[model samples]
Target chain A: MIEAHSISFRYHEAWVLQEVSFRVEKGEFVGVIGPNGSGKTTLLKLLYGLLAPQRGEILFELVPMKKMDRRDIAKRIAVVAQETQLLFPFSVLETVLMGRSPYLGRLLFESEKDLEIARKAMEWTKILPFSERPVEELSGGERKRVFIARALAQEPEVILLDEPTANLDIEHQIDFLDLILTLNRERGLTIVMASHDMNIASEFCDRLILLQEGRIYQMGTPEEVVTKENIESVYGCEVWIDQHPVSGMPRISLLRKGGR
Target chain B: MKIITLKKVLTISILLGFVLIVIILISITMGSVKVPPLRSIRILFRAILGLKGAGNETERTIILSLRLPRAILAGFVGAGLSVSGATFQALLRNPLADPYILGVSSGAAVGAIIAILLGLGVSSFGLPLVSFLGALLSIVVVFYCGRQEGRIHPHTLLLAGVIVGSFLSALIMFFISLSQKEELRTIIFWLMGDFSFSNARSILIIFPYILLGVFLLYLRARHLNLILSGEESAVQLGVDVERLKLVSYLSASLITAASVSVCGLIGFVGLIIPHSVRLIFGPDHRLLIPASALIGASFLVACDTFARTLLAPVELPVGVVTAAFGGPFFIYLLRTRKAIRTL
Candidate 1:
């Protein structure tokens, strides 16, 4: 579980996150939904210890994040950001093996145990077939899967993903989300994912945290949080909300200005 | 499944080591007077084993006094520059980065030129010391200039290096304008890169620096691999990115300074050799660094040998030979590779 108290982050004299506080319970699938510039990515980075909150502290498992060593934090938290521009050629396997870096000692190569873990991670992500191919040669969806495999190779207890399906096609979006959902359901992996797609978030997350202009607008189950008024107020857009006939979860349909 | 296994890479490295030994023997035997490769090998072996009468007195004298030290010095310089090149390229996350590209060499050159202007003897350890300071200063300047918000940008770093390099070159010219004809000739020859003045002491002076630098860089190969993935990703993977950058920059600059002090700025070896090794062996620094060092040593020894022998009595600067040979080889590489990948 992770707890952030009164967290605020400023970039270039502008506060991207202000007085934001939240808690994520162990093994919970949480989705952070926000419009553009709503500090979703910044919050995830702060939680992962990549950025320190200006006025708040983040705690992981009752310990202040500041007290934890980087390697220690890395062992427990894995992050996948929007696709990184790899200027160098690394094979898919190499990229995934980097996930084990926190576990290896200095001057040590990948031991049999490390390789085995990486192999299992690759298998979980279904990226084992292209393990020898250069990451640069992979499609965007495949590369995203590669990154997920890398995060899984860390064997971290918590996974933080920033827009993991941003550029993915519909099929790959469903595929990628299914993979994350399977990890959360079967492996009990805690996931804190930032996403712009409300339907996907509503469908997958056990709970939703809606962010508006650097503050949490609402936090609850999708039915409680994804109400029509809440969506319009946070996003400044009108929306219609109804229950999914299949899963009984809240579904949102936007009201475009032409129709409105 | 691994495309390039550790075992295969190790075997190739060992094979290259043998090839390097053979090249060293061939290089020592080559000059205005040709000594056979077998005779050269015997002389070297006997000398190493402390046995006598492997060759006549003249052959022994040539092998020991003229060729051996020079060959060793060339080997060190080549290996040092090449490994340093690999380090800079990885640290900067740009394939185009090398010591010369980063202006570290030019900075050291300024120090050497200043020492020569002050009439410091070429053999004096002061030359190497000053050069080391100069190289360190240049990297500091470039590093500072390139950094924005605690991160180094590849574009800014490359631009800063070019700017610093040109500034130092101008300073060198200003001093050249103030020098007498004899000093000018010496400075020009040094700038073009020469090993004619190499001796046993120079070899000893440069060896440890290269060895230490290469070993440290090789040890950080995994860190370098992570770094090339991008700083944020590297940090996420638990690497202390800033510390890795600082250590690699220092080690690389130290070796560049040592090599530059002993033999003036040799261009292209640093740029060409490592990139070539990367193309063949992939960008895994564990293999890339050592392979670059071995291949660089062989390449420079051969180039220096040709420099000494091609015109018979008139020796060309080895830098010229490298630029001539390396430039073409690099172009060929660019044309041949389907795509350039960063690892």
Candidate 2:
């Protein structure tokens, strides 16, 4: 449903993404994996229209991204960025209702229908109980859920996320991945997420794209792309690749260079 | 915006409106010449409705000619300052942002002081016009100096604003030092802010600009609420972030220019009222904007009343009173709300 065609982006003089192109079919769950500074976040931002590429184009279903109205694009594509800081104390409900803004008219307030949608999104994310609580007071994990709920409230066909579980604990990470997988399965939602967790990416995503030095190194199923050689070459880390005992998905284990 | 239930928002707005009416009545009643509150309210209503009343003509003259216009101008100034303050805080995403903080007041002060030196005093329409021009120029400078890659960096903007503000203050001081004794006293009094010069014509001049600016801002309250989620998120949510920012900046600066044009740099009404309102009511611009307007109007009316009557024959500058009250309140807020940081 989304395509990045020969997209190149740079900040000042340093090129962060160079001629990087990819495609995601409808209802596909794709994960972008890369080492630090490999442009994982940059690629996601370019795809979501936060940055205009220097070289090429992004298309949503066939329309050029630049041609589409921002509101129209927003209705179809929601983004859950990394951690957001708010100076004022907005309640969780208020933050979620802001997701409905794209759907609202200039002078119109949120209708009862909008409220119902927001509440349902909150309920699905299990944050309905914290609706009245200030969002600033929430934990990192809970805040991630609130952001996910906000994305759901956008009712978009595709969701883009940048490092959704970067700072999370293992338990929260599993819960977060589980929630995302459930959304993809139940709603047939197309999700493209940038993640640093190779294991989570291998276990959860239908396809993975490994990026190295602002270029796409490989794109395929996890078993096809996440080989020992690929990991070593891209990340400069020696690792052993094995299949998970229960899920039969590829798993990676780090190796010491000279000894144990 | 819907953080509070609709019922609660309605009740609070209605209550604020009532308080505003009571404040206006009391403000017009207490002045150099005392008038009963009931009589003052009756005179105001009769005057507004164009009905003849049996009250003494002196009371009517005092209420209609002097006190009423001063009270109304004070309310307008208060409302304009507070709404613009709220808008700036949201636009810049900094709680410390106000017209004064952004160098807009200093710019306007420079223009007004120049007008005073040139002998174009409060009665001249040119003073407000020049002040508005000066304010617009300062914003342009701030935006130019602070922008990077089409976005205004918060830290750079704040630093540029402070630099510009102090530079303008120095210029104002130079002009003040060059003026004669009478001009110096007049400039200082005007800088401190006094409602005594207010008349019906000044109200007529300020009314439309403030109304238009406030209306435009109120219409964008939802957009501003979305912006509170941070710029990139707001854009992803279809806020048209750049356009919204431009509109908000222009509208807010426009109103600030208007208020500073009429009342020379009333310091704390802009800074304190909106911050206090946000602490009480959650940061939903829909409620925050109008609530700030109402509370600001009433608060200024009360302050102006106190300013005029506190020393009997010698009136304190309304700015002095507001600063005296606002400075400590701001400190209290900063101390109590530990979440407030340099951003």
Candidate 3:
């Protein structure tokens, strides 16, 4: 479990995140939903200790993140960030093996155990067939799976994802979310995913946190947070809300100003 | 598709090591007085084993005193510059980054010029020591200027290097304008890079710095590979990005300084050797770093051989020879292969 006690962060004069506080329980699949510039990415970064909060603190299992070394923090939390550029020609296996860096000693290379773990992760993500291919040659969806496999290789208690499905098509998006959901259920993994897709978040997440202007606007079940009024108020857009046909979860659809 | 295992790295190292030894022997044999390859090998073995009376005295002197030291010096300079170039490319995330990209060479040139103007004998340690200090000073200034919010921004660091390099180059030009006629030739030759003045002492002086720098960089090979993914990703993967940047910058700078101090500014070896190595081997730093060191040594020794022998009584600057050969070969590689673009 992770806890944030009124954490705030800023770069220069603008506060990117302010007075934000939340806790994620073990094996929880939480989705953070927001419009553009709503500090969703910053929140994920804070949770993983990539950027320390300017005020207050984040704790992992009741221990303040500030006290943890980067390697220690990495062992417990993995992040699949948006826009990881493959500038070099690293193989899919090689990229995934990087997740074991926290466990590797300074002078030691990756052991056979480490390779086995990486291969197993690749198998779970269904990228084992292309383990020898270069990452730069993979499609966007395949690359996302590669990243997820890398995150799995870390064997972390929690995984943070930022806009994981942004550029992915609908099928790939659903496929990605389903894979993550399976991991949460079968492996007892914790997930905190930041996304702008309301319907996807509503369909998949157990709970949702809606953010606006660097503050949490609402936090509850999808039915409680995905209402039309809340969307209009925060996003300044008219919208229609209903239940998903299959899952019976709250679903959101955009409406034109004078058409609906 | 190819991941570099330790066994693969050792194999490639042995192959390249043999290549380097072959180049050194060939270089020793092909100089002004042509000692046969067998004789050169025997003389080198005798010198290494500290044996005597197996070869002619003059041939022994040529192999041990003059040509041997020069070839060794070229090797160190080649290895140092190429390793530094590879490190800089990784640190800056730019394939074009060379050993001189950070203005270290220009700073060293300024130091060497100052020593020459003061009439410091080239045979003394004063010139190289001063140049090394000058290089260190430039690294500090560039690092200071490149930091943003206590982290090194690659773009800013690169810009700072360019600005500092140009400024120091201007100072060099000013010094050249004010120098006496004889001093001008000395300064110009040093700036263009020369190995004619190399001896046993110069080789010994630069060996420790190059070895230390290369070893430090090799230890961080995995971290450097992680960093090529992007700084934020590297941090999330448990790499202390700032500390890695600092260490890489300092280590690479140390090697560049040591090389420039001894042999002036050898161009193209640093710029081209890493790319060639990366093309032949994959971009894994463990293999790339050592491979670059060995291949670079051979390339430079070969170039220096051509520099001294092509015109025989009239010597060309080793820098000129490196650029002359390296530029065309690099262009050919770029045109013929798509792999360099991945860099």
Lowest-lDDT window of 10 residues in candidate 1 chain A?
A104-113
lDDT string for model 3 (A126-155, tens) is 999999888999999999999999998888
Candidate 1 residue pairs in backbone clash: A88-B342, A88-B343, A89-B342, A89-B343
Q: What is the TM-score of each candidate against the true structure?
A: 0.94, 0.94, 0.97
Give the number of the best model, judged by DockQ. Answer: 3
Measured with DockQ on alpha carbons, how good is candidate 3?
0.70
In the range A1-260, model 2's lDDT, one tens digit per residue, is 88899888998798898888889999899999999999999888877778889899999998888888888878989999988877888889988888888899585477888899999999999999889888999999999999898899899999998998889999999899899999999999999989998998999999999999999999999998999999999999889899999999999998898966
- Tell me, by lDDT, which candidate is best: 3
Docking class of 3: medium
Candidate 1, residues A77-186: lDDT per residue as tens digits? 99999878687678899899989999984854787788899999999999999898889999999999999999999999999999988999999999999999999999
Question: Which pairs of residues clash in candidate 3, taking residues 3 or more apart in a chain or in different chains?
Answer: none
lDDT of 1 by residue, B1-343 (tens): 6644567668988999898888888888888776777887888888889888487889888888788889888999999999999888888777777777778888888888888888887777767667767877998998899888887676788899899999998998898999999888878878989886456788888899899999888888888888887888988988878778877877888888889878888889998898888777788887888899999999999999899999988998899999999999988887876564433
Candidate 2 chain A: worst-modelled 10 consecutive residues by lDDT: A105-114
TM-score of 3: 0.97
